[model samples]
Structures are given as structure tokens and as C-alpha cells.
Target: MTTTALHHRIDGPDGAPVLVLGPSLGTDLHLFDAQVDALADRYRIVRFDLPGHGQSPSPAGPYTMRGLADDVVALLDRLGMDRVHYAGVSIGGAIGQQVALDHPERVLSLAAMASAARFADPESWPKRAATVREKGPDAMVASRPGTWYVPSFSDTDEARRLLSMLRATTAEGYAGCCEAISGFDVRDRLAEVRVPVLAVAGAEDPATPPQMVRIIADSAAVGRFEVIEDAAHLLNVEQSEQVNGLLAEHLADAVAGSRHG
Candidate 1:
């Protein structure tokens, strides 16, 4: 319920290290709900709605990946956070990559989940963006489940929650993110990421897929990869425990290394 230019919320131990969690395009900061209780004990968790999603107001029209990444830096500056550990899913992960590339000093570590250096086919995004722009969010709902989750997860409470998140999202916001993702090709620059980058994949995710994530891991100078089974695009929610454990370890190690070295 707190308001900012970005609409953020912070919780967990007061003096703990900062951990900023970003959301995929369809959902807001709530995408990390399942991971919060598990990691909050050790981190000051900052979660926020991206522009035009949930509580955050959208900018006029289209948004670039770099633009969104800069918005995050602004949020950190607004809160007096010099640097922080960053984690995100899908579009969120893409933003993390941009930050690491463009604003290296601001990231302690990165957890890039269910994301890739580039979308499988870059051309597909503008088409999708155009559809949402013309028809609206409902135009995307019909085919989302196929890429978002395994067939079995489509009926669960979490699935319903995600569906609602998608519906509640503004078409312009979603389309803007699509434009961002469409042009996002950071593969050539991955070696420039100085911080540790942990790339995570859902084994069954048809969206970004495992191969895409592995490429991210291989591309980064200090990247590592993990694949969680029985999950799809929304791996953090479907396999929350496994993803949380991976993230907790990555963040801890990153923090320890940053301080010690």
C-alpha cells in the first residue's frame, strides 16, 4: 500500500543486507511472496510494482529495458541504498542484466530466473505487443498458461492468483515491457558483468526454456546455472522452496564475498 514513483514495500530485519526483488511483466512485486518469508530473516527485502503494473502508475506509453533498469536505480537512490542484491523473473531478470551492464557499481549480485540474454525469437515480441495494444490484456490470457506453467499447475490457487495478476495488468504496460524484452539482446555483453550472476531455469518452461538460461550462465563472466523440475515460466512460484534455497545461498555467498574481498 505504500506509494513511490515505483510503488515499493520493504520488510524483514532492519539492518539486514538489501535484496531487491523484481517481478515479471504480468505480475507485480507479489510474484516473490512465497520466497519472502524464507529469505526475509536474512535480508531486507524490497519489492515493487513495475511501472503500470499493480500499484505503480504507468509512464505515458512504451518502456525500454534500460529505462526500467534506470527506474530501479532511482528507487535505490530515493531510499539511500547505495547498492543491493538483485533478483527477478522473466522481465525482472532482463532488467537485472541491464543494470549489471549499464550500472555495474549498483549491483552486489544477480539472480536471473526463468530468463535469457535474449528472448528465443526477438521478432515475436513486437507482434505480441501490437496485439495487446490493439486488443488488450485478455488477448494474452488465452495462451499464457501454456508458457507460464505446466498443465497441472493451471488449476491451483497460485495459478489463479497469477491469472488475476495478468488480468489486472494494464495493456499499455504489458506491451511496453514486451517492447523492452523484444529488443533485449545482451549476449555479447555478458562477459562484462563483474558481479556473480546466478541464472535459474524451470525445466519445463517453454517461454525462455532451459537452453536460454544456460546460455545466460555461460555468457556471464561469473555466472552459474540451475534447473528446477516440475515447473515452467513462473518457476519461483511453482517451485518456491527450491528457488528460494538457490537464491538464499547465492545472495549469502555474494554478500560474504563482497565484504571479504
Candidate 2:
């Protein structure tokens, strides 16, 4: 793996087309562990923690999802990649959607997992954002693991590790991202997305449920939705195998289409 001072890590082969992977809020590029392993042989994977989330420097915020989308574009330009297959989970999904919408030529295909075009009500998310900003993600986990994972899924070690990651988020970065999501609304612009899209939602995800995924999928002219069984909001992690399989199948078809074109 190779990385720049900007905190983006470029792994896998040099000649392969890149697959830019973005993680959910508070988490780092580690969110793509399962997908990376599965796709490493066929594609070069580029994964990064957003600024302030992982190794990336935390610039003081009041940030927006569009701003984060710009960061991804910058990363691509820095790598000299004209276009790439983009995949993201949750907030990361919002970022990918913005990038594809704003910079269409830079995106070859889009896969949004467990995300919503518009964020939920501020009243519902405000307290959680405040608690995370002030006390960190741990407080929220104790209070509402349901936002990130299902009840039964939270009993395992993986669940503990994932929750700890959210709890360890830096106040500036986490709060900024929350603020970004608070005002996020991309419903009207979904029709502008001309790229092929794969919208994945967790079957048990209360955050961005299956119906919400359908809304997103339906909005795009060329989009499909898939629900991963027994998974919640953090489907990419909790149901990695199923998610990875779906991703592999979609990516294979995407790559083949690109080659033919």
C-alpha cells in the first residue's frame, strides 16, 4: 500500500483501475476491509479516512457534505485518476452521490450503501450529534446502538470495535460531519445522476431503511437497490460477506461495460 501526506492510501495493483472507497462518519478507511480483500486481486483500491476522521488532519469545521465531496475529487486529481468506481457507506455514500452529481466525468460507477439522499430531521439527530461532539461516540452507543447496529449484532467483538471507533472520533471532525448531514438534502437532484448506480440498504436498517433505498434507487434512471439480510445501518461491516458479494457482482458487470465501451 502507498499513501500520500494527505492521508489517502492506495493499495493493490498499480495497473488496475481504481476503486475509491469512502467510510461512514467517524470511521476511517478501515470500513472497507471486507471489500478491499475481495477486490484486491482485480482492482486497485483507494481508501482514505476523511480529513480528521483517521490519520487525516482535522481542520476545524462547520463542514458540509458537498465540501467532503470536493475533498474526494481533490484526492482523485492528486492521484491523476480521470475516473474511478466509487463506493461509500452511510455519510460516505452521501459524499459519493455529491461527487458523481457534481463531477460526472470523474465517476465511472456509483455504489451507495446504507445511506439516504436527505438526512433525517435535525431534531432527531441533534442530540446525538451534540453528545458525540461533546462526549464522543461512546455515549451515543450506550444510548442508541440502534442508529449504527441492530440489537443482536451489538453483542459481538466486531460490534464493540466498530462502536469504539465511532466513540473515538475527534470532536471537530465528528461535529462538522454531523452538521453536514443535518442539512443534507439530495432528493431533487437524484435524476441528475446519469451514471449507473447500485444502492444497497440493510434489511433491518432503521436509519436508512429499505424503503429509503428504494426512493434513492427509483430517483436515478439507471439504478438498482439490494437489501442485505439481517444487517442494520452498518451493513458493510456487520454483513460484510453479503455486501462484498453484491459489490463484486456489480463491479464485474461495470468493468465489463467499461471495457466494451
Candidate 3:
């Protein structure tokens, strides 16, 4: 599959191990601001925006999971990163899974946060794509508060900033990702992922609940599962300190395991 030139930002010292962070759909790389701030001192953090989400240029519609995964690999190649630890939220997590499944050698570890091995029924995504194309990204804005965070967090300034990202997302870009998600189903292939996997779920997340996230942990060769209370789909943003602690430990363990092996 052809790769898209995804827009990205790099942080941390030159010689540190590379750690790639992927953002959920609608939100840009800034979705990982908290993680970047906490981990950049020890890891070379690379955060990227999906096609047309932030600074990335809008490409044609109907992208695939493999295609999005390829875009990440292309970015890694450009940055001269041979292998790295990866963590992502929602659609970003799906892409991380795809990368692990397709290019295991390039991933040292995987953290799937508020994500799933398979998103909702495949048919629903195309319909969502159609809605976005017809009404623009604004159409999905109303439902995000309920699905993305708890009622309390939804009304905060941080939540408003995230919602603005969805509003600003181009119809074609958002719809294209929706189509990509429609075709994404890696449940059966989870066992093929050899790297260690950390699957996190938000206790209040109605989108990808703990049950859904647990499937990833149960199926992967080396996996762990954890749930954070009082958060929803965008748990990393809502529970930054806890999420950062988990990631720090996961990355450290993976590095140590690699060294011993």
C-alpha cells in the first residue's frame, strides 16, 4: 500500500530510545501532550497527526488500516528509527496494532489505550463516514462528549479544546479514517503480534469498554490489561498521571526484556 506523508513532531534527547505516540481520531498529536511532557526526558518521543487532522494535508478519502500503518512506518523510516516502543489511543491504537501485526520487527512494545481489536460492527462505520461527508465533521460533535469523556470532564476547557479538533477536521479526512476503521478487524490476528502489549480501558468508556479492551490482552502472546476509573474514551487525557506511570513501566520492562534476550 502507498504511504501518506503524515505530519509529525519530535522531542527529547538525540540518543534516547525512540517512542512513538499516536493520537485518537479527531484529536491531533497534541492529544499526547501530557505523555510527551512526562516522558521526553528519557525517550525520544515522536507524535504524529493523522491525515488532514492537524497540519497533515488532506488526501483522498477511504483509507485502510494497512495504509495508515504504512504511513507510520514511512514516518519512522524518514526519522531513521529502526524499532521503537509505541503507544496510542483509539484509532491510533488500532494503527499501532496493525503495525505490530504487519511489521513486528519494528515494534518493541505496544500500548493500546481505549481501543479494541475490532471496532463496532463494520457496517456502522460506513454510515458514519457518509454522515460526516454529508454534514461535515460538525455532525459528530454532539455525540463526542458522551462517548469521549465523563459528564464532568466533558464540560471542562480541555474537553472543549478536543471537541474543537473534531469541528476543524476536514470531512474528507475524517470520513476517510472512518472508512479505514470500518475495514479494521484484527481480533483473530492478535495472537500473531509477538511484542508485549499493554491494553488499557477507561472504566466509564462506553465506546470501547473494558471487555472490548481485554480481548487484546487475552489474545496477544504477552499482554496485560488495566482499567482506569472515572474516565471514558479519552482516558489518557483525563487520567494523565496514571497513564504516564503505566507507559513508563511498560516501556522500561520492554527495554529490559530486550536487553536480556
Candidate 4:
């Protein structure tokens, strides 16, 4: 299976510990702007765009979570990174799970925000993929505002920025990622993850509710779950301060654990 060399940008100190950030489907690397700003001083922040998103090449159809996780490992290999702290949202979060399960030694810790071990109603993802393949990413834009954030955030600049990213996403890229998500299910494999996991959920997230996020925390060998109030699917964007604080603590704890281990 050929892997895509995903487009990426790096921030923070040159030799600091690496922290990789993955964005949700339809969004690009910019989705982690807040996290980069908050953590760049201490960690080498690497943010990558999924296939067909941002400047990444839009390859053909049918991507798998394992394949996507392999692409990430390829990126790490190219960058000469032995291991990293990982965090992701939505499909990105799913990819994080796959990474930890598939390449346990490469991941120091994982923070999955607004994601699930197995997405609910797995069949619906392919249908969404078909819709995007037929009508393009624009077809999904109308419903995203509600599913992505609370009603009060709709008109804000941050909200608009995210929406713009969705509108700009290529149909092939968006649909292929959807196809990857459709077949994703790691509920039974969480027991294999040796690294620490932090599952953050938006209290009001309709897409992947708190219960879904909790499953990852409950199943993993070392896991913790948290819920942010008045947020939805994009909790990191909607509640950046709170999310950032949680991440800071999570990463710090991981570092301390590694030192003591």
C-alpha cells in the first residue's frame, strides 16, 4: 500500500520533544493553531494536513485507518523522529488510536479530542462519502455548523475560518477520508495501547458524544476522560483555553512518567 506524504508545518524549538497534531476530516493543519500557539515554546509541534486537504496531494479513492496511520509513521521516519506525543480531533483522533495500536513504540502519549474508539453508525460514513463524492464537500457544509460548534459560535471569526476550510476541501480528499472513517473500529484493540491516553469530549457533541470518548479511556491500559462544557465536536477550537490547559497537563504528565519509568 502506497502512502501519501502528507503536507505539514512545524513550530517550536528545534530539538525539543515532538508533539504531532492531526486535524479532523474536512479541516486542515490550521485546525491546531491554538494548540501550536500554546505549546510551541516547549514542544516541537508538527501539524499535518490529511490527504487532499491543505497542500497535500489528493490521491484516488478508498483509504483505510491503518493506511493513514502508516502514512503518519512514514512522515515520522522521514523527519527522524523516534517517538512523539500525539493529539487529534474527529477522524484525526481515530488515526491517533490506530497509530498507538499499530506503532505503540512510536507514540509517547495520545490525546483524542471529540473522537471515538469506533464511530457510531459506521455505515453512515460511507453514505456521507458517497454524498461528497457526488455533490462535493459543499454538500456537507450546511450541516457542519451545528455539528461542529454550539449555536453561539456560528458567526464568530474562528467558526468562519473552520467553515472556509471545509468549503475549500477537495471532494476527492474529503470523501476518501470519509471512506477511511467508515471502516474504522478499534474498540476491541484499545487494550493493546501501552501509552497514556487522554480522551476529551465536548459535553454537547452530537457526532461523538461523551460516552463514545469515554470508551477509549475506559478500554485503554492507561486512560483519562474529560468533558468540556458548552462545546461540540470542535471543542479544541471552541474552548481553546480549557483544552490547552488539559493538554499541557497531559503532556507534562507523560513526560514525568517517561522520566520515572
Give stretches of model 1 more than 4 Å off: 1-4
TM per prediction: 0.96, 0.93, 0.98, 0.99
lDDT of 3 by residue, 1-261 (tens): 357899999999998988999999898999998998899999999999999799887898899999999999999999899999999999999999999999999999999999998998889998999998999999998899868999989779899999988888889889999899899999989999988999999999999999999999999999999999999999999999999999999999998998887
Candidate that beats the other on lDDT, 2 or 4, i.e. the better one:
4
RMSD of each: 2.5, 3.1, 0.9, 0.7
The C-alpha local distance difference test score for the whole of candidate 1 amounts to 0.89
List of clashing residue pairs for candidate 1: none
Candidate 1 vs candidate 3: the TM-score winner is 3
lDDT of all predictions: 0.89, 0.82, 0.93, 0.93
True lDDT of residue 69, candidate 1:
91
| Model 3: worst 10 consecutive residues (lDDT sum) | 1-10
What local lDDT does model 1 show for residue 184? Answer: 88
Q: TM-score of model 3 relative to the true fold?
A: 0.98
Q: After superposition, how far is residue 226 of candidate 1 from its true place, in Å?
A: 0.5
Candidate 4 wrongly placed segments (more than 4 Å): none
Count of clashes, each model: 0, 0, 0, 0
Report clash pairs, candidate 2.
Answer: none
